[model samples]
Target: MAEEDAASKRRRLGQEVPSGGGVGEDGGDPDLIGRLPDEVLGSIITLLPTTDGARTQILSRRWRPLWRAAPLNLEADFGSLTLLESERVASQLCKLLSAHEAPVRRFSLKCNGRYGLSQPIAPLLQSHRLQDIQEFELYVRGDLPPSLLSLSPAALRVLHICSRPESPLWTTSTLSFPSLRELTLVDVDVSESALHGVLSRCPVLETLLLDNIRARRVRINSLTLRSVGVSDCGYPWEARLEELMIVDAPLLERLIPRVPSHHLVIRVIHAPRLRTLGYLHDDIPRLQLGTMHFEKMVLVRPSDGMRSVKILGLLSAPNLDFVTGLLKCFPCVEKLHIVSYTQMIFKNDVKCYAPLECLDRHLKKVQIINYEEKRADVNFIKFFVLNARVLESMKFVVCRDKCGAKWIARQHKKLQVNGRASQRAKFDFEADCSRGPSSMVDMKHIHDLAMDPFDRSSCRCHGDALH
Candidate 1:
């Protein structure tokens, strides 16, 4: 009977216990992972999902106590679950929470349907065990519980809330989070007062991202914030960031804006340390960078330009004249990124636009996304290769279907790489084969937009994938 039990134990651990029941029988080492200290094993359990972590207790007698002692990371993802399945999972999670011995460390619950709001998510979140949660993320279809806003502000460092309803998630008049460093709000309806309260309260916030959020004319005023991203935010009917005023953000560095579908107006009143800014397209009716102003990307009035900007992104069909005019405004730019789709006739000569400050001294790296290799695109590539004296590297992210060794060689000849002005410049051709369409501003949150947000080498270059 005892021999049979040992074999069963080995089978449960995915190991073959020979009839001899000795290490030499299989000529393999003993269970090394099973010999690890309880503390290390407990730490590993805390990193797993709630259900997975709990289920680990069934692995063996050694693992039974480890799970109960480890901190819990509760993740209830109902994106794939049906309405009934989601409710059942929610109920199971509540029971598991009641039985858990340690405090919850990270909580993430995302439900796909409207039935998610009807689930008993409030009770689970409001439980006393969740007060010490350090990271909280919730995405549901209706208003959130008041207790959600009242989580231990001092303990929480990250907060992500996505409300799918038409009304605002924050029904309370007051909202505060003194210790929060990163905040992401999506599809939430917020009033001017609530917006001010949220921003003003999170004094230590470093990153803030608002996506598809509904609010009035947005105004950002912060001291510690380093990065801010806003995309398609407005009233329900229009659904665009109508106007954004960076009134005062002394420490701000990166301002990433994605407006592929709607028009936006931006004004920078005071941000001395701002360095990275972009995805500024022709649809932007007006843009003010300190004393300089642009109407539909055309410089209207000019004083001393914004020299603080180093990285700039332009999304438009290839137009050299429009590009040259914008470059003249930010003369000290080091990295120039242009994402163009339309192929137009190349009229202006590259020589005519010579003596540009960026090309002559500052510009080092250039990236052309969605390179379709049209006649105009070829001419555009030739312009940079023949210019940009200090350029170090140029990358052309081509659609997968349009890229190959022969095509690349043809492009090299057309671009006249041999006669390139910059001797040190290395050219790289990447084939983007991602399923979805590539985006100029590819980021989930503001923090994801690192120092070089325009660089696509890090991500899978889904250059021009057709859905």
Candidate 2:
């Protein structure tokens, strides 16, 4: 009896006591993982990627029932996948989900199935098993039956749906998804009022992303909202809304927006926490980021004029007046970045240029790309070095051939003697010019625009991020 008691102690804590006795006569060692409680083991299994997690069932009898203990965290990628393979994967998910006894925690189905076999899975979307779903992402080609996504939205935390232009999710009524935190939508057409209703409903929403969306106008109002991104999101010339307004959001930190046509005006007011702003690589008329305490901001050289910008980014600094006028807005910007360095032929030389007072105390970093070794361009850079008291690093990027040894040596000596206000400042070497879509880091925020935001012409950056 004492020997049997000792053997029992060696068995896994959660393992069922064997009816034959303490030890399986052929045993080598007890399963270490079996010692953990069932719920704890379930959680460990949940952390694995979809396939590896599901494959664990074959390991032993204990894990066979564990897969069904928690609804599968199944994610199927079908975007570039072949139609037959994608359909097979989708079919399996549908079958597994329908037969699942437990609730699904997360489900992601993505693809543009060319074979049109996507409709058979519509019944799975309406399953009651999704009641416990915490995250749901669906990026498919055609219209999703409205009944398919009729979940209460209360349990949802992350919702990303990119549907067809013809049939979008109903934003006409107040969408009650108070628990939703991140929402991404593409190609959803809705009226301005309906869009407003959706925002008003999601009480705790933090991130909102829209791509190729249709709306007469969008007016945002949220106390808990943090970030908003819009690219190619309005109607054409004669039909666009008068303005896209952000009425009030206290927690908003980063805003990168783009509009389809040049006629729409984007406005922001009462949003105090806004820190990052830009990606004006389009023909939108104007953008107002708010009135008070605007600092540490990323900016674009106002196509309209100088009074509109804080930290100026230029395709071309047409004249000295535009530069000075821009500095006058936020004279102490810490970092200044220039993307295109082509000299613009000024209409006329102006005598009025304001001195920048904020440079000596605040500006520290500056990066210039597509830099042409023009005399005036050198002078513009020299002014910043001479005036920036706290200046730390200055960088330049040009075409592969432009930064020859002689050219770099010439500019190095020239700027050194030009007299830097900060003694410790250093210059970084020029980077290679990358015209390829992959190298455009600054353009990352509004990447969808490069893919032809107005139409379905394929944006490479769509699947990755809104950085």
Candidate 3:
């Protein structure tokens, strides 16, 4: 019978050979096409599922023409397909990416719903083998087809355009990019010549982030901007910033040319490379301190003429006589941090001068964080144990649990029975639940009373030693 027809033609070539070994038993895995690497076997036949990324050349004659020299990631999901099946799969992947001549780095499209913006993204922005388009993400939430802002400065670094603030492509105006660095404009209603025509055409721009953008007038003179972050700007911006961060410029009262009705103002004239001056505003009208040289100075009102400060932080100025007239404008302060806020105390304005008897000749270390025992905080800690004279340490931080820790242990047993120099004052008391309902007391009596903690060297024969 002709040897039974050669055993039924070797059992129909072992059922055409593809059970993970093509052509050994005569089916198809020549060690999976010698473990694929012509761009990883053309990205595994371009991720097979359009009946296999369009038939992966019948999966082996070494994936025949490896997806025609692979490098095309044409994506179109059009959210559940069928705007005529996403324009017939974007016109057959733009005719197989214009007969592919090898380089199409990445082109992604996810047009959710309303996909009608004159659909020809100029064949991937006029592709001449696309010279390095790293990432171009467009999430068109309606109205972006004025020829997609005519993009083709080619070599685009990173551009993210998110449209829909009431999309008429958000009023487009000739935005050109000549080798863009990085740009992000979110929630756009941009105008002010389209934000100075995209910062005068992105001249190798470094970093600019504008959120909730609404520009009616913004003139920034950038000398190669280091860092600029403008938040919620609805207008009133006249910039010459080197490092300016203005938050909620509600109609910003004044910063340049001294408009001081305060929300935050930093005017450092002859600013010798100003270090740090931070103010978090609730109400700021006039906080002007020019002729400045800072190491660290933080003031929240009680306007001053700060002159060469070392370290000063005073928060919640309940006008302690206007903070002792702004500490006579810092005549060389070493260290002082006094933060008291409970709407700054006013039960008939209960006393507050004792800024250590008005800056007792350059006070050393006085830290009172929320100390509320109040005879104006023990007459501001007994005027820093009677006029600073090099007071090394005084840190009283007892922030009221209706403040009466047995009336502060009966005022330390009535200052150790009223005499013996109030038991040689070098106080220390700490029970801080991290700044609320506090109790932190530390006073290393100044002028080196031999580094007094009541001068105790194992209690130096226990107290009464301040001769």
Candidate 4:
């Protein structure tokens, strides 16, 4: 009777049932996953969360002893636990570390203490099992102990620390990152000299991200850095990062800034190999690149420009002079992306402006995200449509709710589809309501965004109208 009932459920769910024997008994397929070698199974188990990895003991007989030998992945979040509960869990974690014989590979701890009770994570980090940890992430609500930053492991590659609201008071004179390649620090307070010292200690550092760091001034001088991102440091009224000066970075390729305000002054004194830059906005009061300077999105001196810059991003209202003037500083740009949230209204044509090197010969692609087909928006696109002689493709990404067949047709006419300067230029329209206008460069994927970070032409397009 029980076999009949179980067979009925399997049939209803469209599952295959053996006719002559139970599953894996005689006629059914064998358990392939359980047949895997213990080493492979142990590696897979270590990738799971701490609790989930331990729970695998009940999966089957083969998986019972695997978790004990797998490399540890210890993660604890005390935000939901009460004071007593959190202490108990912390004690259990300590005991587990003492008993576990395998090495620790990944450790992540995030917590918001209550009633001024903070859990000390320094002891866990100092454990012998964690000496070879490769990745570590710590996000604490209160101030962190000075000892946390002093520990230097030769095997550590990635370290992300976020101490919000309150910053750490470092007593250590120097912090070392021997093998660290990617480092991200958020809301931590470090003096100008101490910040420089931190960079000096990282010998092979490749990617560095500073987010909302509470420092009066941040200076970067690195020898082996490839990418650097400074985002959301602070506003004008706050006593946070006011000046970001990249004094010297020989191999720097990409420099990205997110949510930059007028209060932040960015100066790139020397970066000869800089190839990708911006999300350049008019809100930034001042930006100094090499010898050229920009005051509120206007290039003060156009004679000095970086020929190495091939990709550029801009966030602004419909101001042709501002865009044209800025492009002069990057003469060899191959791809250009512009993101606009406010309605664009161009009052006049592309006045008596000289020909730009990028538009005349090098420029190949252009994209305008959040295109609304406003008179100025179309006019802004028309400048590139008519002048970019070497252009091969142009795309206007519109929101789904504001796009349709009729709207697309009207845009083709307004843009003068038949009179494009580049005879090979293909115009396309894509409607995507999922996301608003945003730059292509994201800080999370800093290393992967190498050259043409703003180019998203590879993504599938909807409502594509090509001519």
Structural similarity to truth (TM-score) of each candidate: 0.84, 0.69, 0.22, 0.83
Q: What TM-score does prediction 3 earn?
A: 0.22
Which 10-residue window of candidate 1 scores lowest in summed lDDT?
18-27
- For residues 350-406, what per-residue lDDT tens digits would candidate 1 score against the true structure? 667757887888899888877766777787778889988999999887766556678
What is the lDDT for 414 in model 1?
88
User: How does residue 388 of candidate 4 score in lDDT?
Assistant: 92
**134-178 per-residue lDDT for model 4 (tens digits):** 888887777664446656678998888887646544423477879
lDDT winner between 1 and 2, please give it. Answer: 1
Which scores greater on TM-score, model 3 or model 4? 4
Q: Write the per-residue lDDT of candidate 3 for residues 1-467, one digit (tens) a residue.
A: 44335445657877433333323334332455654457766776554433345477775675567666765555554655656776676667767667865555455555643556346444545555555655465655555555556664556755655555345333546666667655555445655666676767776654454444444334544434332223332223632111233322221211221111132233333332222122212233333355332222335445445445444545543334544444566555555655555555543232334444335556666555566654555544554455556555555555433334576566544333233222333554433435631111111111112232211222333222111
Model 1 residue runs over 4 Å out of place are 1-45, 54-66, 78-87, 145-152, 233-236, 433-438, 449-451, 460-467
Least accurate 10 contiguous residues by lDDT in model 4: 458-467
Give the top-scoring candidate (TM-score). 1
Sort by lDDT, top down from the best: 1, 4, 2, 3
Q: What is the lDDT of residue 12 in candidate 3?
A: 80
lDDT of 2 by residue, 9-86 (tens): 646455455432343334644445666677877888776657878898997777878877855686877667675676
